[model samples]
Every structure is written in structure tokens, then in C-alpha cells.
Target: MNYRLLWAGAISGLALHLAGLGWDVYRHSRDVTLAQREDVLSLANPSHLMIVAGTAIMAACLLGIAVTWMNERRFGGEGAFGGLLRGAGLPAVGIAAAGSIWLASRADSSGHVHDASHSHGPQQAIVLDLPLARAVGNETAARFVASSGGHTHASAGSFGADAAMGEGSAHHHHAEVPVTAEQLEAAAAFVARLRTAIAPYEDIRRAMADGYLQITQDLPGIAAHFIRLDYRNDGREMDPERPEVLLYTKRLDGTWRLVGAMFLAEGVTEEPPSYFGPLDAWHYHENLCFVGSGVRTVASREQCPGAFTARTPWQLHVWTVPTAGGVFAHDMPEIDPGAFPGAVLPAAQELRAQAR
Candidate 1:
């Protein structure tokens, strides 16, 4: 008939649950704000929200044990058996807490890992221009190569002119680099393996925590909300087939679809895979300022004090989506809005606008 013990335990459990829920909400809010790109928030997705709920439940159970022990002391029921039970629960609670922490950390790292909108000083970065005339063994052929090298953002009103001129001049340089049969074979083999190894969200979820995919960054201002997959931190050597990052474009319909893959190797002397060679544009992002809302590119490492420095792996995008930028262009501003399967461009635009 000792109702005090029961009441105390119930109150403690409820309070702990509420406290944990509050903490989780605060954490998620902060994380969402720091979510690198506008579209990359963690709690915005259902999969990540579930992890937050589970943590609250575990916290309630853990605090409930503490209340039961306190009541045992108050009632002078601290016998050998009572003591044993109380002690036993502590270890179980500890194990459960550990597991919960692991799951929580996994969720955070996987979703936020790609938000490298933060900068990394160019410790290992080697910035190289694209379309370096690798295939043009003779000087005559090299003269035709468009020497623009990297992307130059246009003023707000100049997007159309910039894109048009780029297509007129740079298009041939991007596409005309003839692929040798051997190089084509190598690229095809690598793409096949990548396709087989990773899928949309499900299989990618597994690879996110494993050694496969370890970094992600949102390429803001592109036509499609594009996220770059990276592997510089995966703690393993990367091969040609295992690209530095897999590119995914978010449809206006709130679904993420695979658009391309990027291959990058560290070190200044390192060259891209034979498949990429000099045909594809390889680019890197150097110093960037990361804020709670998004990332801003800076001129130099000194420009952004205390900001993270991100030295990118040399990159080549293999666009699978029907992009205005040819299949091998680094990025495309002219993505066909209506091209995504199962999504009407107008509806997607409305929905994505609301989502933002």
C-alpha cells in the first residue's frame, strides 16, 4: 500500500522524459540552423526525427530507476535483496544510455557530415584548373581548349548571358575531349560498381555510417539543390570506382535523387582517374565562412577568422540527371525543371518553396 514510491517514480520518469525532449528539441534546432545548406536540415527529415523521439523515451526509463532507489531508502527497505536490485539496474541503465548515445551520435554525424560548408584551411588542397588539354598531345589541338579553368559566378542579372556564352565557348571544350576506348572502359566499370554499391536513401544510410561515404557539402545557388558526397574523412584510401562524393539533387517534390558522382584525390601532384583525365572539369572550394543559415565562399583563409577551412578533393561530376551542363560539367545552372521523374516542375517548385 506504499503509494509514495509509485508516485515518486512516476513523477521522476515523466520529468526526465520532458527534460530530455526539451534538450533534444534545442539540439535539433541548433543543428538545423547550422545545417550547411538551406535544404540540408537534419530534423526536417522523418528518419532523423525518429532518433530524437527514441532518445526521450530512454531518458524517462533511466530517471525512473533513480526515484525507485530513493524511495527504498526513505522506507528503510534497503535489505540485501533490495540493494542488489538497485545496483543491478544501474549497469543496465548505463548500457542502454550508451547505446542511445551511439545512435544519437550516428544520426548527427551522418546528416551533418556533409555540411562542410564550414571551412578547412588548405592543408592538403591543390587547386587546379579544369580541361587541362590532357588528350591534346599536340600543341595544335591544345589551342582549341577553353582556358576558363573554373566557375566564375555572374552578377544577379547576368546569369543568362553568362550561361549562354559559356555554352557557346566552353561547351566544346567540356564535351569534345575524345575518350579513348580504354578510358571509356575504365569509366564505365567504375560507374557500374558505384551504381551497384550505393542506392538512393536506404543503402546510402548504411554506407553513411560505414567507411563508404563520410562527408557531404551542399552546392548552394545551383539550379537543383545539389549536395556533394565526400570521402576525405572515411579513414580509407579511395579508388577510382569509389568517388570522393556522390552528387544528389533535391527535386522540388522534396525527394532527393542521384544526379552524378564526383571523383577527387588529395595532394597537389595527384591527378584524377584515367576516366576523368583532362576531359572533365575538376574544381575545389577553398576558404568558406559557415554561418547558422548557410555557407559563404571567401577569398582567402585569412578572410574568415575562426571559420572552418575546407580543402576539397579534386572533383569531376558525372551527371546522370538530364542537366544543361553536359554529363561531365562540374555544375549546371540550366537544369531542366521538368526532367525529374514523377514530379511536375510547377508543383515541385511550389512545394520546395514552402519547404524552404
Candidate 2:
């Protein structure tokens, strides 16, 4: 038997398999890290575990090599029995190691499939009378926001401050593909159906009861005028004609009118769509806290004790309703500063504080 060639083939297979596996893990972890730079630990911990596992796999390979060499030296490398034993043992160990690693990879992929199947979108915060920042500070307020059903709509006159805003903000971003006039006309027609079928207040109640709409957030200020809808987790696609959230404005007579809608995918990385045009921008909430009960916008997940802060999937709003920052802008027109709270950043000079 050509023992040298046999050993060469065995080692080559093992090396190639390990290298491929290592590269795959490295790429996946790198993507996760780049996407969630603020919440490094979310993926870093798992990556560390994977490193340990790879170390063990390498150690096993080395140990097998050592045992084979020792047996060859003691029993002689020329005989039929010796050759048979060495051939059987080396190939068996190499094949087993490669197969095990491949199977492990398949199992990990299955976990991701399971997660996607049970994906969740943003937490729907029901209407709250209290201030948004203060609500995050109070446990009772947090629980209420987590559980309350949306309240009555506020008057549309409250949104008059946003009416004068420019329309260019929403259409400013570039489209991924050239948006033809035909597509724009089609989108407008689809929105018209939403306007007619969905009333301001009563229809919202029916939609929620029918499981079509969910109340996501209650924008700050006296007006219960702006409530976000979570179209995600409802098996809806990020179709421009059928967005995830249908933003509504409450009229003076206490009716709700469709204003805008958000488009998004659950737990995906930076690849959010340019549904309207290239000028359209998609954003995700960073350092957001998701305790079992409520979601809080914070500087870092570390700010919330025992809370898991991870990067949220990308989402973009398209306002059919008029607003200051344009219809497709990120922030609501003339919105209260406290509507989405941010964490306080430590001073750059404070080295110890910066580590946290």
C-alpha cells in the first residue's frame, strides 16, 4: 500500500473540510458583528462558543494523527495486517470528523430556520397618557404601555403643524430600480382602497379584532393622533401597495385617516428595500431593550439590566399623509423630541465609563 499517498489524501480531506467550515462561521459572525456593532455581545458570545468547538475538533484530529504514528512505529508499517489497520483507522477517523462537523453546521442552520418561522416584529406599544420617557422609567407605566388597548383618536387639527412640510423628503432617496410612472400610478390606486376600507377609529377596532392590524406605538404629546401599526408577523410582505404599518391621523371629528405605512423584514441585516426609489432610506433601532414585557429605546442594551438589547431589523416609513420631513421621512413632522427616547452617551474623556 502507498501509505504516504493514503495519509496525504486523509490529511487533505480533513484540512479542506475544516477550512471551509471555519470560513463559513467567520463570515456569518462577521456579518452579525458589522450589523450590530452596538450590541457586540449578542453575537460575540456565540462566536466564542464556536471557537471553542473548533479548537476541540482540531485537537481530536491531532490526537488521531499522533495515535496513527505511534502504532506505525510499534507494529511496523509494512505488513498486510498493519496496513489494513492503519488504513481503516485513519480514514474512519477523518471521515467521521468531517461528517460530524458538517452535521453540526446543518443543525445550526436548522435553528435559524426555526427562528425565522417564529419571527416577531416590533413591540406594539398601546396608547399611553403619560410621557414616553417617563413611561420607560416607571414599571407600572411600562406594563400599561405593554398591555393597554389603543384609545380613542385625537382631532386631525393637531397635525396641521406638519402640513406645510415639503414633499421632497419622502422622494429624496434614490430608487434601487428605476421607478416608472406606471408603478407610481399602481401604488396610488392600492392606497386608495386602504383609504376607503379603513376608517379613522371604528375600522381600526375592527381590523385589530380581525387580526389585520396591531397598534405599535403611541406618539408623544396630548394628541392620540399618531399610532404605528406592525404589519410584520402578520405574514405580510413588504409590498409598497401593502406595507407593514398603516400610519393614521385622527381627524377633529375623531375619525382616523390613513397617512403612511412602514415596510420591513424581521431580524434581517442592513439590506432593507428601496421600495419607492433609491432616495428612500431604511433604518433600524439600535441598542433597543426588549425585556419580556416592553421595548425601550436606549443607548446600549447594557444600559438595561438583564435585558437583551439587539439590533432590530430595518424598517422605512412612507407617508401618504403630509408631514414636515416629507412623507417618507424618518421622523414625524414637528414630533415631540421625547417621542423616541435615546440613551445618554458618556463623555469621551471618561475611559472607564466608555468601556461600558
Candidate 3:
């Protein structure tokens, strides 16, 4: 058989795979859209499609080299000893060295998978009626003392349950909540401050801390519109603590909308100190995807259709507010601000304040 065709195909495939992977890395390294970057990254990893192509190419190259050596020695007076000597010859060694280096580099280029422990997104606020915040705060405290179990969704929404069919009733009864300039500034500044505070470790559990952001209409007897936080606890060092350690609660305002998010990491009390903060949203566990039929959370044992597990070891979640129909099926971006427009910088000056 002609080893020439095999060698040509192998070299061409190798080049193609390397080029594709290289472009992916370059695109991710620079600032880009979240969807585009992630899509590119998924294709470039060692265990991805590109890597499979490279592996096939490398195998073909080895086969070609072996056949070439055998054919050469057979046609001439050379034998096994001669072929072995030829294999270690200067040209062969140099080719082997080059291929080894390329494969090694490709493997190392992947590094660790991306996740919450590696991000610094925005920290937008979800301002609600003060009464709702207090109500959630109060109910969260009460539930902890009463049940001795932790809560994830606030006093308004339930994590595991679907929004009730009355969800569409808001169209007739309530008006659309308009976004305000002042509220926009507040959201921007909130994210700016958080992105600065959790500079180095902003991507992990610390990022999930204090995640509740309220988007309220600020009306009495109405749902305040709370966005819940959810996170997956996989490949992490979360300590298995006492069941009495955390308190979470959700309330009903006779409406299906969320009112507020409240978490109690420490002890129960009347206006006493709580360990968990609502800087982010408080969810039992966020579904990385909710567009499909099933839901998922931390270390979810099952895969949902239409949901892609990130090419990363991540802390993932989903945010929910009562929607016009059944529920909001939006893919809420990860709550880190560093990648947002006019985001805040994580500086040394901010470090001192957090330390103190």
C-alpha cells in the first residue's frame, strides 16, 4: 500500500484541528459575547470534537510512518534491525519530537474548566417594597426556628414547584413594571461594588453570597418580583454541616409572583444577625437550563433536554420572577459584572476595605 496518501491525510487533518483549536483560544482570550465564546470553547477542549480529529490524525501519521519503513526495507536489502535504526534516524526523531510537542501543548492549553470560582460578573440589585424584604426576612427567621431545615426560595416563590396557572392573571390585574433611571444606576453601582469586593474569588461560592436582587413594583398587597438564586455544589469543598445551619423561606402574596429572597446561615432571631447575604439570588439549586421539560441543580443526577452542561466545573443557577403567562423562560446570564458594559474594576484599594 502507498504510505504517501496516509501521510498526506494525517498532516492535513492535524493542521486543520490545530488551527480550529488555536482560533478558539484566541477568541476566548479576547473580550467576546458570552454565547459565542462558550460555543467556541466547547469545540476546542481536549475531550471535544477537535481533539477527536487530532487523535485520528496522529494515529494515521504513526501508521504511515510504520508502513513507509516496512516498504522501504522490504524493497531493499534492509531488515528489522535496519528499520529500527532508520526509525531513530535524525529525520524520524525530529518528526516524532515535533508531534510530541504539539500534542503536549494542545493538552496543556485547556487548563482548568471555567465556572463560578473563575468569574466576576455583575451584581445588579432587585429593589423591592421594604415591607416585603422585612416579611421575607421575618418568615425566613421563623421557618428556621420552627422546622430546623434550610430554605432556598424566598417567601414568594417555590424552587421545585411550577408557577401556578393563575400566573396569567397578572395581565388583567397588574400593569407592567417600568424600568427607572435611578434603579438602573443602583443596579449598575451594586454590581460595580460587588465585582470589586470579591476580586480574586468572585467566581465561586463567594459569588453566590448575598445574591438576592429585588425588582419590585413597590405596591402594597402586590408581589414585589423577587429573583431567586440557585447553585450547584459539585466538585466543591462545601462542608457537610448541621441541618440547623441555614434557613430559607418563600411567601405568598395571594399572587403567584415572588416577593423577596431571605436566607439565614447562622441562628434564628428577631432582627438578629444572619450569615448568608442576599447579594445574589437564593435558590434551592438553580437549573442551568429551564427551557426544556426537566430541571437541574447542584450535582444533578440527570440531564435535561436542550440544556448543555457547561464545559466547566461550575457553580450554576437560574433566576425566576412571575412571568406574564406561566413563568419567565429566560436564560439569566451568570450574575457577574466584570464582563458587563462599563463594569467596575477590582482594584487593590477595594481589597483593603474587604479585609478590614
In terms of lDDT, the best-performing candidate is 1
**Per-residue accuracy of model 2 over 1-356 as CA lDDT, tens digit each:** 34465456556656655665576576556433122112222222354344435545554556566565657585545778776776576668767866765555444211010010112222112212344313122322211111011111222222211223357764332112344544344334444444444444244454345444322232321112222344465566555434555554332222343445666665566456444333344555556554432345666556766455466566655544433333334444332222222112111212235457
TM-score per model over all chains: 0.39, 0.35, 0.26
lDDT of 3 by residue, 1-356 (tens): 55677778777878767876686566445423233223222333443456556755766676667657655655334767666555555356556865764565454221112221122221222334433233223322211111011122122322222323456563332222343445434433432333243343322223224442232221121222222233222222211211111111112222122212222223222232212232222212233433322222333426544454432221112112222111111122221111122101112222345579
Model 1, runs deviating above 4 Å: 1-178, 200-204, 207-230, 233-241, 269-276, 290-294, 300-307, 333-356
- TM-score, prediction 2: 0.35
lDDT of all the models against the reference?
Answer: 0.42, 0.40, 0.32
lDDT of 3: 0.32
Give all candidate RMSDs, comma-separated: 20.4, 21.5, 19.7
Off by over 4 Å in 3: 30-48, 71-318, 321-356
Residue-wise C-alpha lDDT for candidate 1, range 208-297, written one tens digit per residue:
454443223234323222223355544443354455555544432335455556556555334433333433445556665654324556
